[model samples]
Target: MSDEVVENDLIHCIYCNAGTVRFSEADMVSLLEKAREANSALGVTGMLLYEEGSFFQVLEGPAESVDALYEKIFRDKRHRRITKIIRESIEARNFSEWTMGYAGVTRQDLKEIEGLNDFFYTKKCFTELDPGRAKKLLEAFKDGNWRASLR
Candidate 1:
């Protein structure tokens, strides 16, 4: 695959995984702050959703920058069993406004997040979700449906 990142091409990569080590609330906040700063400088836009030690993320931007960030994530020693849900070039971004929008979904919100009921209800034990389904789930959160519908 070409690692070249043409300025005009926008690429998005979505993935999910369970954490190898638990992150405290403070740890999550600090991590998000660092990620937003780094991703902003790199022109990356995405959303990160964490629930019950599992993470679902969608990162979109120049190919080179997204690839570099994924490389670091793969080696972070925190994420385990990473499985990519989708990777493709797109004309636009779903999260163009946020460097890294994030939400830490709680148990009460799980049942109302549309596609994530099983994930949290079942204790985050499962294989990869279908690509389209995964995309919908990400979009739902990115579009503020998760918060509105859940609350």
Candidate 2:
């Protein structure tokens, strides 16, 4: 028998999208370009969903790196009132293949993405968003996106 300890290197974080100026579709696309470049360099992977004027994003990666990235993102002027829905160590990455996945919200997606509708019609500041909801959304996004990528 051997005595060895393995470290947990994974983390998942979800945050609310708040700020005065809402990015247009083109603006968000440009933002995603920058994010993909930066995330690839930092070994980060995640998904960003934008709809109506709100955003729901899940970023996962090395704990330290993900924490750093989230700090920068939280301070970003384009967003505010960030509420962390989840933060825990994990065995694997849900979005291992994506540097930064982008999902521009459509009518059909409204019912699934947790904080979208509240942010859309009720002006919720991600107050009621929970970790379970966030996890489910991220997993579904990851699975569907990966499946589609394979085709």
Candidate 3:
């Protein structure tokens, strides 16, 4: 078989969830480290944003790998009420530069972003956000339009 990835071979998924509890800085660091290692091994690339106790993530890779990873995340006790916002085939990776790029967002940062609803700042999860809004948020992050500290 040819070792090549075509448009149909790739999928991108976006999801959001709330943390079971507030995570300390060290806890976040540890999470990022483990995620980076796991995603790199799976040939996945994505971005993760944490605001308060909520998480918004974008994962892109082979369909099988992405689906498997999403299943693992869905079952993890660290998260609650996981909601998938988008899943679709893509021609190229949106976050190809990072195994898992991350940002610790703040209320002020949310306020600075236009088009996001007021609810985004008060809620601990993004389950209510539509796919269009979620995609806009991801695009803003990808474009470095937000002031959140990213890594």
Candidate 4:
């Protein structure tokens, strides 16, 4: 690949975190609006899923932009116990159509994801999830295998 091609290569980061406080529907709407605006400006694309009081997000963009955004998320007071699950270069964005796609997950929606039985039964927070399982959840969302309400 040319230097320019390599320089423009995309990278993706997947992470999960606990909410400091349970977010209301209004709060989620506001958060998604702001995220979409900011991610659009940064040329980032991703999906965000919230269930109970936990969050799972997949962010893809230029490496610097993704890293910077992840740092900002890491320091955000709204989240706690943040755990990064994946970070690697990608050939292209998996969520290029959305600046920030969002879904509010329910227990029923959790049951639809194949490998998340543990979460369904134990109510484990996303931050406590296994990395491989986290990736599967992301793929499920990407593939429209979820029935969660979207935003």
Q: TM-score for every candidate vs. truth?
A: 0.82, 0.77, 0.87, 0.88
**Candidate with more favorable, higher TM-score: 1 or 4:** 4
Residue pairs with backbone overlap in model 2: 18-80
Compared with the true structure, the alpha-carbon lDDT of candidate 4 equals 0.83
Clashing pairs in 1: none
* lDDT (Cα, tens digit) per residue for candidate 3, span 25-117: 999999999999999999999998887788889999999999999999999888888899999998888788789989887767766667775
Sorted by TM-score (best first), the order is: 4, 3, 1, 2
Model 2 alpha-carbon miss at residue 66, Å: 0.5
The whole-model C-alpha lDDT of candidate 1 against the native structure comes to: 0.77
Question: Model 3 clash pairs?
Answer: none
- For each candidate, C-alpha RMSD in Å? 5.6, 4.9, 3.5, 3.4
Best by TM-score: 4
Cα deviation at 94, candidate 4, in Å, is: 0.8
lDDT per residue as tens, model 1, 1-151? 9764445778999888855567898998899889999999999998887776788788999988998898899788887898887888987777777788887776667556677677657665324567866866866776765634321
Tens digits of per-residue lDDT for model 4 on 1-151? 5553333668999998865569999998999989999999999999888878889899999999999999999999898899998999988777888898888777677876788876767866575777788877877877764623445
In angstroms, the error of model 4 at 80 is 0.9
Stretches of candidate 2 off by over 4 Å are 1-8, 112-127, 144-151
